[model samples]
Target: MGKGILIHLQDVNESKKSSKLDIWLDEERENLLCDITSLVKIESVAQEEDPTSDEPFGSECKKALDQFLYISRRDKMESYNHDGYCASAIIGSSNKTKPEIGIWNHLDVVPVGSGWTYPPLKCTIKDGYVIGRGVQDNKGPAMAVHYAMKYCLQQDLIKNIRVRQILGCQEESGMRDVKHYLENEKAPNYSFVADCGFPVCCGEKGHYNVTFKSRNYFSRFKELSAGTAANMIPDEATAVLVTEQGEKTYQCRGIGGHAAFPPGSKNAIGMLAAKLKKVIGRDKNYLDLLEFLYRTASDGYGRKLGIACEDELSGKLTCNAGILKLEQGKTILSLDIRYPITVSGASIKKQLYSEADKSGFDIIKEEDDPPYYMNEKSPFVQTLMSAWKEETGQNDEPFVMGGGTYARKIPNAIGFGPGQDRDFSVLGLSEGHGNCHSADEAESVDNIQKAVKIYVNALVKLDQWVGKGMVNNENI
Candidate 1:
């Protein structure tokens, strides 16, 4: 677990300026904590084995969705569940002349890996932070949006706008929940996903998942297994090798993070493969594959594969070998790649196939999703950035990201904050302490409260901006 600068709850209250929104947030802070705590205790990790016709992800996900809808109904907001994939709570009535804005969030969390001092399911409030699995990645922000909408409803501030908070249960696995929801409903013309950083995410790189399989035997390697999910960097990996003396076990450890941002976390599968290459020598075909992974795929860029590239807006292409396993005499390696927005999926595939042919591996399966980009000069992007700047007093420009969010799913959506770069630089704390998808995930209480205020301001501003026809509806 990463250590963060501990702050007391009192410090936040003292430092914040007294404003109507801030005062209201201060008064409702305890209740907000209670809401998050209650929701986190349900353990809403999606499981494929537990899936049913009624509960697509699992019963735990269904439980989380049901609980969220229950809270929305109690608050007197209109709530609806789309089968079992997703649920939504509408805070305001649609105005015939105004555009509806959607706030997208996820209820599902990643599996709780080992090494947690606090229980992963219990939302622990200590040292002015909410510590839990979903607190940082999504759950906390979802709750914040819930309260933001509630605030809008209570104040009757949503006169000419409609704000719908859509919570999905399959963001971690694949975005099937949102897909199902879109099938039944039209895409919101202007929306924001509260699953990323502030200053707004105007561009997102393309996403690709590729799996390599080889049936050829490894003479000296017996078994190898590592990784939890395709979208997360593997933190730990183990390999059993048939050595000269006997079977030998080896383990490698590295920091894990979301694959989109690989600089912060290390890849354990790459580490183990590099070590095994030295032991087994590079002459073997298996060692050759390991060498390819360690050299080209280990680093964020696709340097060794000769496909490393970048663009001015979305930056460089990144590749993470997230999953690796050797079973039933078949070795498999799964890669998560985020390519530059300017790059074509067909070009990337051709390059990958050429390299695989030379490296003695077959492409078992591949999935490609094109990049998503919004013009920074557009009214929608500017409005979101302006809202963030006004609230935080930060003048940083809107930037692109390698991570994919619900923003990509929605027609005209971008990723807005529950995180800010300053949280890591100035405050000595990263969102969730920079432990998303890793053990001991957490969210700062101060950040959560701050996010609520930002969301409230942004929603209010958007309502006025869109209601007045300041936005280009055609672009959306």
Candidate 2:
């Protein structure tokens, strides 16, 4: 997402400069593309709880981990799988004397959504861009981080700590994979999650997950279903109703996006419910459940539910009725809410619980992660921003975003980039065609190559700071 610091471009007449590192980077471009393609071919979407299954996340996630490690081993790199939840590829020796640096990226992607000309699973290369489900949001950046490790090694740019790239399997659904990871292994001293924009992300908004189940089943409706993930806005919703004539099927379509940034996204679940409120004709059979959906899901903000709030640093509090279905003869709604950094999770819960109770829905599940913020004046952040400035000749500063990255959970970590400076319009794709959680997700090849250079530079800088003023900044 182009949510990072705004970049100031140089004059077109000033030709771009090239270094020896860039020359070597060009040679590895094909390898990088092959690595991304290998991982993206698998539809690694997170699935529901399956206690009987062998893998922790799901079968597809297991396959993703297997393929990632197999490629690393085939490339003569040391790789490890953490019980099918996460996988790691290591470069250089491990020494506890120095900090162990790590790079975090996720393997699992959101469900393949509607409206796509290109296949969602295949990594299609067209017009200098890699198009697929997970290419832009994660898989493409994951491979870019992997190549940065190679570049660091080949140029002898590392001496302090071994570089490890950790790929987790559940980022879109919930961060259960991260909890399992921290329990089994040690957290990296100073690391970065390559899942956001550049120069660096100093703050990530708090994420509050809430679910509501209706008090009673709909007496007048036959059935209803929509959405697959908690973090994506529902694009289409279907409802079958017992009308005056007979049972009729009604469908509602709206724009979808990642719930963290829901400005232009319209909730189809809310749209359908609002229309049905008028169509139900004072029957009162499904009035209670219908009113709840219409009030909360009608807009991107949670104003109707009285949970809306905002602050300057992290922007507004966004809510999405991502999942709607019938379970145990009751209507259920899953919401993904991202609140401001200055707000407290307890306060949000207090407001949300009161509202849900008033609206006649019981809270079944709640997951909360408080906001994470790093001082912009810190040496670690300055170093990351320095790397970006050096690479792009821009003097952009650090920024705060709503997207909750691993930095919120990992110690001394921040959201770095495969920057959003890439031109997705290169392929002439229309609007709604190139976002992370939407269909036809893509990232430019040239953009990823540039990211490799930035990561290598950042890695080299991080390695040099192992012994110096490494105080509050653990890795530094």
Stretches of candidate 2 exceeding 4 Å from the true structure: 1-18, 48-54, 467-475
TM-scores vs. true structure, each candidate: 0.90, 0.91
Residue 15, model 2: lDDT of 31
**What is the lDDT of every predicted structure here?**
0.79, 0.80
Model 1 residue 33 lDDT score: 88
Q: Candidate 2 residues 341-455, lDDT tens each?
A: 8888898789878877776789999899888999887777877787788777888778888887777888888899985766766777756667789878888888898898888
Q: Write the per-residue lDDT of candidate 1 for residues 164-218, one digit (tens) a residue.
A: 8999998887898899899888777688899998878887999999999875766
RMSD after CA superposition, every candidate: 6.5, 4.7
Runs of candidate 1 exceeding 4 Å displacement: 1-18, 49-52, 94-98, 281-283, 422-433, 466-476
* Strongest candidate by TM-score: 2
